[model samples]
Target: MQSLDERCLRYLAEAVGCGSVRAAADKLNVNASAVSRQIVQMEGQLATPLIERHRRGVRATPAGSLLLDYYRRQASDREDILAKLTELKGLRRGHIDVVLGEGFVGDLMSGLLQGFWARHPDLTMTLDLAATNDVVRRVVEDEAHLGLVYNPPPEPRLRTHLAMPHPIRLLVRADHPLAAHPGPVRLADLAGHRLGTMHPAYGIRQIIAAAERAEGVRLDPVLITGSIGVLKQFVASGIGVTLLPAFCAAQEISAGSLVALPLADPGLDGVEAQIVTRLGRQLSPAAGTLLQHLARGMAGEARSGTRRSSSSR
Candidate 1:
């Protein structure tokens, strides 16, 4: 059996990335001849050329490609072993990576992340804000450890960990006349009212569009934006109202800056905020704990939203 060490793997990977043995040596702070010698030794032992020298630099031969894949997998396995070791000893060294919709990353997540980190100071967390489609795609591709998105379509490569009802709500300034209503708001009530909302591609916008079509009303928003922050600001200006997920605007509603009202229509009941991950991946202990905590909060918030949506004026 031909035994390959980590040093050769590192040098080869760097050489491939840099496209030249000399450049790889410069980056690794070693002599170019030394890197060439290592490659030659490996080729002699394995009975194949690892690199093909060319005018533009060098390219990996078929055998070298196989070795590179092995090296990549070996690194991944090592990380997994370290994660397990961390769990067995204590939850001190493991980390988590989460990708979620941009709309889900406001004041609510800020507080939750801070509180979680305060308790587990040694564990690391990464937040990647993306569109819902991109969030699901990235999770399916194993680019992220977990995902939080609303109204995601089914994907075979993804597994749903938790799903909670999260119906859309009307966001209006507290001083707006519509804020006087005690019950859920209806589309007809919004006739002639200027509105601000996200663009057509967003899930919330799709829900709003479907509702508008059913009510036989036309709501050409005065402001069409792709930014949740921009929509919130526009609604707060008292010139228009925007519909959003109740949890997304929880802070503004509580602060009396805006009011939340649910739609009375039954056609929009399937909307949900879901937690997802790659179908076959195992989460690290730190990631698992973080996922569970986020899931619990989502469930509680969803239930509260349901109650609010059903309230009467």
Candidate 2:
């Protein structure tokens, strides 16, 4: 068997990263023809076409994507190893990517991440705040080292690490009629209520949809908004009612601006604030350390019980 040169693989990686043979060649300070010829050579050696060129750019074929995945992970592992060796010499530096949901963006994640950075000034971290499903996909695809997600989508490629047990609660203004309702409220009772919610892509939204389906009822939320802050604001203004993770509305509930009510029938028995990562992707040392910190932070929150409603407690 002929061994492949590490340089050719690196060149292919650069081309894949740039999405252009010419751009990769320019970046490598080589001729575009050379890059093209090398790509052809690589395809012939692999016995498959790696990329499909288009007017706009190029895209990897399925086989190409699979090879890229292995190649990228190898590269990432090599970099991680070097970073660890550098840390031994007091050079401690590397980059990590994290994707989080919107609800965590303003408060929950902000302080934690800032503190993490302060503690490890040499490590570079990039936080990408996105919708729940997007965050899940990023983690599964190895695009992110870790993900802070809520009501995560079902995927076999990722594993959920419990961050905080965030119980889902019904939110309404302090003076709203539902706030004064006597006993445990049922899903049937909320059938026609004005419910503010995020887009369909959100995990919480999916949870709600699942419950509705389980109950065989159709819920017509009066107002559907994408932002959590906006939904809270609307709830505070006595606009509508919606289910939110208790932690997300902790401050408002404590301030008496919003009422957090527990749903009796299904309850939030399985509701969770999760840390997601690729099931088999190797974590860099820094990333592993940071993930451990994140788990600890979430454990603290769970212990504090400030995020869960009294009924849930």
Candidate 3:
């Protein structure tokens, strides 16, 4: 068999990734015909159809799937090699991609990123906010070097580096009726009040849904949003209560604007803040260092009790 063309392989990978040859062409800034021709050449060389078209977009055939996996692994290995070479030259420069849930943003920005950047000044980082499931997907697909998620579901492909219990809490304005409840807030306590919540994709919402089922109660959120910022604002403005880990509203709680009340349900209390990476993948030096820093920060939050102010609430 003839050696496959590297350009053809790249075009094939992009086409599958984008789910259409034209979309891949737009991404690569090339004519659709050029991408199509490259894919055709690859098919001819392999003597098999690589992709199948459907209503949504194109999908890889069995053979194409194998090739795609091979390409991705090769690309990842190349990046690892290049990173190691750069480290050998004493250049502390490499890009680290991190995908995480929005709840982690406060802690990451306030405690981790600045210090990491100071130590490795030449390194660059990309922080992409996503839901729990999306964070897991990005790490499993090798799109990100690290993931910070809250109560993510079990996945064999994910390796958890650090996990700290950060229970879900009912967030309300300081002057709200439940603010001085003096005990764990029950779902029954939320009755007859406006409820704001995250979308179903969020891990926080997933835990909330489980608690609702276990306790035989249904919560109809008056407002549903994907952004943690919006949820904070909703509760801060006294619009309604929302479920979130205390750390997400740390600044607000500290500012005396919002209060984090522990939920009565044990299921909600089981939620954890976790740092994860793809299992078996070798991380770049910068990523490894950043991972350690993140773990330390998360551990500190747990030890110091990010929800310590709830007692005063």
Return the clash pairs for model 1, or none. Answer: 182-312, 182-313, 183-312, 183-313
For candidate 2, the lDDT comes to 0.78
Report clashes for each candidate as comma-separated counts. Answer: 4, 0, 0
lDDT of 3: 0.88
Best by TM-score: 3
Which prediction has the highest lDDT against the true structure? 3
Each candidate's lDDT (Cα)? 0.80, 0.78, 0.88
Worst 10 residues of 3 by lDDT: 304-313
Off by over 4 Å in 1: 1-81, 106-110, 181-184, 303-313
Clashing pairs in 2: none
lDDT sort, best first? 3, 1, 2
Q: If scored against the real structure, what TM-score would every candidate get?
A: 0.70, 0.81, 0.93
* Lowest summed lDDT window (length 10), candidate 1: 72-81
lDDT of 2 by residue, 1-313 (tens): 5555566666677787788888899899999888778778878988888888898667788887877777767776776777677667653777889998877765455477778777888888888878888898778767788999987867888877765667677898888889998776777888667888888888888888888787777777777766888888888877788888867887787788998887764735477888888887778778887888888877786676754535565
The positional error of residue 133 in candidate 1, measured at the CA in angstroms, is 0.5
**For residues 181-235, what per-residue lDDT tens digits would candidate 3 score against the true structure?**
9789889889998999999998998999999999999998899999999989898
